[model samples]
Target: MKLSKYLGYIFLLLATLAACKKDNGNYDYKELPDFYIDTVGVQKTFETPQSIGTVVITPKVVYNGSESNLEYLWRVYGTTADTLSREKEFRSVIANNPGTYTAELQVKEKTTGIRALMRYTIIVNSPRPYGWLVAYETQAGGSTDVALIRSTEIVKTITTDVVMRNIYSEVNGGPLAGTPVSIVSNVSSPAADMLFTSQTAVRLNRPDYKKLQDFNQLFVAGAPTPKPEAVMEVPFFGNHLINDGEVYWQYSGLFIGKISVDTKGYKAAPFGYAIYGKNGGFYDMLNRRFIYMEQQLSQAATYASPKAGSTARFNLGNIGKDLVYVGIGFGQNGVSSNPDTYKYAFFEDIDKSKRWFYGINFTLPDQPDLCMVDISAMPNIFNAKYFELGTLGSVAFYANDQILYNFTYNNATNTASTPSVAFTAPAGEVITSIKLLKQPGSGYTGTESKSNRIMYVATWNAATKNGKVYLLDANPTSGSLMATPLKVYDGFGKIKEMCLKPA
Candidate 1:
């Protein structure tokens, strides 16, 4: 049986060899038609302004095959893919939100079933590129939302008002928790917007305002409690947050670390300024004194005693007054040598009877070159509810009830000019917030001149349960506001905080 099987296998192999020998080398051969997409004069990347409403793209094709056998399709890819066109050329309205997206052009040959694909980058820019961000609280539910007041273009002066309300909910799908506390933006590289509510704090992406980091995520190892007080970004220095009176520091967007200090009985003031390449200035409410933290230093220290014969205006470690407000005021008259141009800290007596303004060079915290002027005599200084500093000169704006006042200080003579009425709201309205439209950058030119001269005043009417924002053009030199507002936008909730959103 084994011999019979082996003979059968040999016969099968011989049959296969004979079949291969009978086959010939000559055979019918054909090549598919050569084709390619001509990229010359094609716009591979498109930046479509939302106001334009349409984008048109025409791609040239080079092919040796019949054009009638090819089918073309176009689509945009974002969170999902959506068909755009079924023709060779793409002409349609791009309704995607303001963001970066991808688009694809597909060509298919019906006969050969061959497909070719080409991709492009698309950028959709919002018409309201940048503006004033107003965070408000609803009167009914006490929920917080934000509004944007922007211009159609970057003009020297904003003549017309374009307001988008409830923008926080529009992008986030819901209102921020708790009541509004503050809204601030970091204009440095990798810009971001930090929004704080009574219950939590959230860091949002610039331009789009999408939530990036929540309250818990802001800390290296989650926060012990949701007691966010304030978050501040100092241009090129760093970012600081005060939670439960403890200060947290982070450079750029890295993990937050607590400053090395025993913050047991002392609580930090809600507002402070961190200057670039200088020690940060913070106030301790419990000790009622000024504290300094060196650049990139983990520990915060107190300033040394003034040297003998030094003309010290006030002792840094012994400021007994309560802090009223702290903000950047003015700068030296184009003097490049002055490191600390002007940072003002307003203080009042323990009984809130008298007010004083302290001007110091943030760069030289230990120096005696400080100016302290008694501003208690300024009209309505004790009654002021909100304050904002001017960027041009030794000027500041303060609001009390429904009235706004502007006053200038003389660092040379240590005197404060009489307060002038900058603006007054209509009856039944109370001023809630005041902020200067100061764009972040060096030098005052072009739009900076106009932005530095503008002021935003927000008011709320209890009877109508509505809020209004007034855009006022200020005097570039004297800081006096225009007699009438450039524009007024109404129908907002109770405004709590306002900040500039740069383009």
Candidate 2:
């Protein structure tokens, strides 16, 4: 009886201990893993900016701890924050608006209790500007050589507006005066930025006969020969350097869609300039001429980009039976079956001029020396609408025989847009057919009316066997903006690069 009673007591005590143990096992206060704003450092993506047009600032979030590949939640705050989230990005357009702003980033952790938050004070108090245009010189000597006849260097002036584009310029106080020049911007920074442009008085050095000779048969520039160190100034901002296999072209001596063939000759090809390829020719589709041409993508060709009056020129004599020279810009070039001899033609040298017309053409406002080409004769004229239907909504007769002949006020009368120039738009009643009202002849024609505002612009950059051609919108009434480039090909041809003159 005594042993049984002791055993019962022992069991009761054991049961009591078990109950206490279970109560302690349950969690009362929870313990959590560490959480924090993962980012520690702020990174500014933009560096060495030369000018300002549109600058995108992508802020980087530096994280700490074990978190990787975290998705970030971004927030922007300034005069407005709650509403701005709709468009603001952690990586957003910055340094453009001259105002104060802050950014917040939160990167979620893989598991609960581990969170990261990064805060950045991006005070774009002012715009940071830098430059890229630099000086380039070449040397050629020994037995009749072409020295650095031209060079395109970088220029800088104290200004608020930033200009961005490939610039070509001449050297002042260096060597050559009438020489061509070029400045190139790779993916490198500051130099590639819009703010930095060269203007150290373009100084021409000497041209490399080797470079000129290396591809001697391929190119012929229309300009007076100048001794090395004798430079000719070009674009106010300087000329842009072309990549290894590229061709640069702009309108100068002729119409928008027309390039001067000879000093006085002009014709409208599908495009403006072209590039040649490994083996052969381009099928000229625009002019329908038969000659060696430039190609685009491996097999695609044929396109046309014609603004109001863009033009391109060609030389029939320079290209040999085995080789060919093609004009490009719009998109394609063609040769005719009929035998023809265009022994010599005038083409604008890419290294020497900016444009005969444009905003900066008249005055290199900041860079005087770089501005040349007496565009003073006609001020404020973009040279495009001269031969086209006025912006008022009707077609202007285009002269077939002569293009870029002379600047005469009587030629193109001012319309209502200028307001200062006396004219009026019919208040109501839209005209149905502009073609019927337009007395058309040849050089150029349109099928649209005044209400045709351009919605989109595109280039038909196609590569062909003879060359290339460009085609814009199909309507042609009010010019279209479809400038997609297509390539029309035949055999082995060469083409480097190309662009378009959109309406």
Residue range 1-503, candidate 2, lDDT tens digits? 99999999999999988877745555577554454543335363333211222334343434444544355566656766532232224434342244445666555655453445555665442222222222212122111101111101111133232322222221121222221222222222111211111211121111100111111121234321222111111122122211111212212210011111223222222222212231122223223322222221123222222233433122232211111112111110112111220111112223323223211110111221111122322322222221222222221211111121112111122211210111111222111111111111112234422122211111111222221112112222223233332211111111111111010
Q: How many backbone clashes does candidate 2 have?
A: 155
Candidate 1 residue pairs in clash (backbone atoms < 3 Å): none
lDDT of 2: 0.24
Q: After superposition, how far is residue 297 of candidate 1 from its true place, in Å?
A: 2.9
Q: Which segments of model 2 are wrong by more than 4 Å?
A: 1-17, 22-291, 294-503
Minimal lDDT window, size 10, model 2: 145-154
- lDDT (10s digit) by residue, model 1, range 409-470: 77777777888999998999999999877663223465455655788889999999999988
When superposed on Cα atoms, how far off is each prediction in RMSD? 8.0, 21.3
User: What is the C-alpha local distance difference test score of each model?
Assistant: 0.76, 0.24
TM-score for candidate 1 = 0.77
| Per-residue error (Å), model 1, residue 495 | 1.5
TM-score to true structure, per model: 0.77, 0.22
